[model samples]
Target chain A: MEDALLQAFLFAQETAEEDEGSLIDVVPGLMVWTFVTFLIVFWVLRRFAFGRIQGLIDQRRDRIREALDEADKARSEARELRDRIAQERQQAKMEREQILEDSRRQAQRQLEQGRERADADLRERLEKNREELDAENARLREQIRRDVVELTLLASEKVTGKVLDEDDQRRLIEETIEEVDVKRLASEN
Target chain B: MSPLLAAAESDFDPQHEFLLEEWIPLHLGPLDLSVNKAVVYIWLGGIATILLGIWLMRFGLSLRPDRRQTTGEAVYDLVQSQIAESSIPTKALHIWFPYVASLFLFIWVLNIIGFVPLPISNDTFDLFGVELPTLGIYAATANLSVTLALALITFFATHVEGIRYNGPTRYFKSWIPEGAPKPLLGLIVPLEVISQFMRLISLSVRLFANMLAGHMLILVMLGLIFIFSAWWLVPFSIGFGTVIYLFEVGIVVTIQAFVFALLSGIYIGGAIEPEH
Candidate 1:
């Protein structure tokens, strides 16, 4: 095999020499060498470089996808939180309105009760004043009658220049009072 | 002769510089296990890619990625969205991601390495007592063998993926469009097979020709100054070469890498779900 290779090489060298480098001749040996070298390169690159790179790229892609998913999750959570807060605020607002309404109703009821109590108290005071006024008028009228009777007695004594006994005077005054009463009744009728 | 003149004269040999050199020679049982500059540069590109992968992996894939991790993720994302996800079915992206990503990165690094100037002192090295240029590095993609090998891999992988997706018998049957008349089968089948083979050739040649042409243009432009050996041509050559170099490195490298990956994805996708 070695002898044959040597002979072939010798023959190629002779031809190469004769041809004087035509630039078209194909060298079988160079082709074989390039093939071997390239194959080795391809193998190395495939096994070590490309293999790892592909894995890494895939991993990076997955990580990015996961990150996007997490971001979506976070955004949803934030939206939920906002919704809950809004609901709570609405509840508080409604509660506040209810409390205010209740207080207003209570105040109105108390005002009405106070007004009713004041009205009752004012009516009672007015009735008591009327009774007092009637009593005072009756007392004044009785006193005036007594004074008139005394004056009539004094005038009679002056005219006669004498004084009457108690029984006689009483009878005379009674007669005069009866006559006055009759006249007053007729006039009223 | 002045060293500068001698150096310039030596530097202008694109044939010597672009051709494969056996930097290290070995044999393994009817196989010539020799290392050429293209292979060496390829090794460098591979090492650089491996180191970058290791550095990125050190970040350990985080949710909050750092700057380095972001950059790494961007590359992976580009491959995943632009190549794997766009090309294959959703279910199949997982299976095809690594292969597609590896191809893109490998080719990308390999294309970009052409811009890196290696330190080779013309003062020291000689080939058969003949003076040579200070540098002899070339992009592996510029080589026919390297591009052919990569395209071959794509071709086989596409067919295999097709078979895996559609059963062996159905896979071949899918080549024929549905609802086509029976008489057209005779013409279409051969054309389809031819086109399939043509894909492989075109894929290989496109990358090879683009890289090769860019490097050759730069080499030829730079070589003009040396070939003319005139002081006046120096600025023109250097200016033009710099502009071309920048254009190649900036635009060509990125476009080629993208196109290669895009085509591979499209091809694999078509095979998986044939138009018919």
Candidate 2:
């Protein structure tokens, strides 16, 4: 069988040499060479080239993904910080308004209290002036009454035109006084 | 005659240019262990890919990536999202990510190497009695055997993952849809088997045809310069060749690598689930 195969190979080789560019010709030697070459190439590339290159590519992809995730996290953190700052600013504005409102209310109460105290002082001064004026008017009336009695007594003396004893003078004055008191009592009735 | 003029005088054959010359000849009992130009380029391309990968890995996980690190990350991102995550099931992405990514890098490096001018001797004619006809550069993926082997790997991986995920019996049972009539299954089962095999052919041919066609078109365009031997044809031929070469390098190389990896992922993912 081996000898037959050898004869066949030799025959094919001879024919291939004669008929160049024959499509159906099978050159067993060349076939073996090509297969061996292909096998060596495939094995070497698989072991060394493909495996290492793939690992590097995968690692690069993983790094890019991690970087993207980190960027997203940073973006969210910045948004949160802005939101908190805005909230703080709003709170501060509200507190300022609250303090202003409290001060205004305090000023209003002070103004009202001052006005009330001034009014009460004016009222007390007016009452005191009216009471003093009444006392002065009552004293002035008693003085006018004493002057009238003196004038009436002088007129009685001028009408009699004579020297009078002490008992007589006293009787005259008492009579005059009783006549004045009778006239004032008739008017009051 | 100068070697260049001698090489230019020779007939330009695309097949002859692409054919591999044995570099190191060895043999086992039934195996031919001769290393060829394509095999050498494959080794060089593989080593270049490994060195670049090691250089990028040295950057580790830098916070500020330099140009090399950035490029490394970009490649990883493309494979992870475009191929693995998009095509494979979520649960199976981790397990299959390396295979899909490695496939993309390996194929891409191999495809792009065609643009770099590495001189290989054509065995067709003795130019000025020197035996070496002309020098040419060829992409390894342009060869059908290489593409076929790659497709076979995907094919085996798909079924292996299917069995691993769904168990042996369940994986086989998944060929026929659930709730299908027994009579319909008779038709469906064979079609399913054929379609699975078709994946192998389609995947292989798709890559093989695209690479081979692109390289051949450039070679043919450049050969026009030699065929005409007119100074006037140089501008057009060389210009068009350059344009096509740039297009292949920029567009074809990237799309082919991406398609192969994506299809492999889809096939494996489909096998695992089998519903869609």
The model with the greatest DockQ is 1
lDDT of 1 at A173: 72
Encode model 1's per-residue lDDT on B1-276: one tens digit a residue.
Answer: 457877879755655556665768877878776876777877888888777876786446677888899989988898888887888776567767777787888888888887777743223467899767565446788777888888898899899989998888888888777887898899999998998999998888778777776776677678887787777887898898898789889998888887788788878887888752
Fnat of candidate 1, please? 0.53
Which portions of model 1 show Cα errors greater than 4 Å? A1-23, A127-189, B1-7, B120-133
Model 1 chain A poorest ten-residue lDDT run: A1-10
Query: Mind giving the per-residue lDDT tens digits that candidate 2 earns over A1-189?
Result: 234334333433554677763333666777788888888887877788777777777788899889999999999999999999999999999998998888888888888888888777777777777877666555544444455555655666678776566777677666766666543543343
TM-score of model 1 (CA atoms):
0.80
Error of 2 at B3 (Å): 13
What do the candidate models score in CA lDDT, each in turn? 0.76, 0.77
